[model samples]
Target: MDARRGWLRFIGRRLNPLTLAAARRGSAPFTIVRHRGRRSGTIYETPIIVARRGPDFAAELTYGQSVQWYRNIRAAGGRCELARGDEGWQIESVESLPVAEGLAAYGPPRSWVLRLLRRHEFLLLRVEGSGGDASD
Candidate 1:
């Protein structure tokens, strides 16, 4: 949350494809996410990087668990189109993944150990309906 990094994020949001693409290749760089626009219901994309989590494949979100993308997928429940490879996958909104389990997936834990050690509070939504996950 340094001022300089914050400023870069603000400016990065405005860069075009060519420049943004270049940035994505840099260290711990950004990844553009193409999601259905919340207000317009049209498709739009935003660039962000993996915030570091305790798991693999599952990236750590830098913002609050209640962030817009976090909330949107929680509401709509759809796939995330990753920018780099233009690959897409089914996404699940999970607020809880046992610390060790997530740690095994992501990393051994450094400063982010706090995230892993935290008490989890998440709402699980199934890819399908009630028949798949819970009786409710």
Candidate 2:
């Protein structure tokens, strides 16, 4: 068990709404994703950092493949709508990034994203679900 991972989990789980809101709206790329709960039938909205590869929009999940959000997308095999402020694009949930590649794609180990990779290799999820669910 990685002590660092545990600490990060603790922090994220305990993050206040204010900070989460700031992170979601700050200069860093932000997107609001709608996904179903793993065990529950209700859908939830979560804001995540947006990583762009050309026209494609991707997200780097800090919980790796085991993260709740990642699993939610996989479980429902549902579409994802990535929204930035008032603008957004629809994309499918197909591309998944593994550890080594995710780390490399995220770049140097000095950035916060690098730190996310150090604890949990991000999920390189792609978006392309056209005419999918974008409405609340």
Candidate 3:
């Protein structure tokens, strides 16, 4: 696990800058998550894949729950900003969704890949003013 984490970190560092640029351009499957550091209070923008489920969004926890962005968002009252193309949303809440339920938010191919990769954890974000249950 440590080795995998190291590899992911290495790859992420190299790819993040490029990914962030594309994400800022409003690329599909890429969303820019703006969050603050839990300790340093420094702001960070992370690129992630998100799937819309009703008025909410679901993000696969590809790096599990221990990722810095996840921790920071959770620590800071589950509030963050998500930008996709020219659209933006104020995420009001974040919560873990059961594997089965979360998987339903994604299409078959993505769900299958995530399952094959053993990435079962997912975060469900509720957008402010977007009413309706997450399960809808």
Instruction: Identify the superior model by TM-score, candidate 2 or candidate 3.
Output: 3
Show the lowest summed lDDT stretch of 10 residues, model 3: 127-136
Residue 113 deviation, candidate 1, in Å? 6.9
Supply candidate 2's per-residue lDDT for 116: 53
Q: Which tens-of-lDDT digit does each residue in 1-136 have in candidate 1?
A: 9996676566656663654475356423565555665576776555654433312133445444655565555555545454544433334433444445444444445325646556333233222222333332
C-alpha lDDT (0 to 100) for residue 109 of candidate 1: 50
Error of 1 at 35 (Å): 1.3
Clashing pairs in 3: 26-85
78-97: candidate 3 lDDT, tens digit per residue: 99999978999999989888
TM-score of each: 0.49, 0.62, 0.90
Cα lDDT listed for each candidate: 0.47, 0.59, 0.88
* Candidate 1 ranges with C-alpha deviation above 4 Å: 1-29, 50-56, 90-95, 108-136
Error of 2 at 21 (Å): 2.7
Note the residue pairs that clash in candidate 2.
Answer: 91-127, 91-128, 91-129, 92-127, 92-128, 92-129, 97-124
Error of 3 at 45 (Å): 0.3
> What ordering of candidates by lDDT runs from best to worst?
3, 2, 1
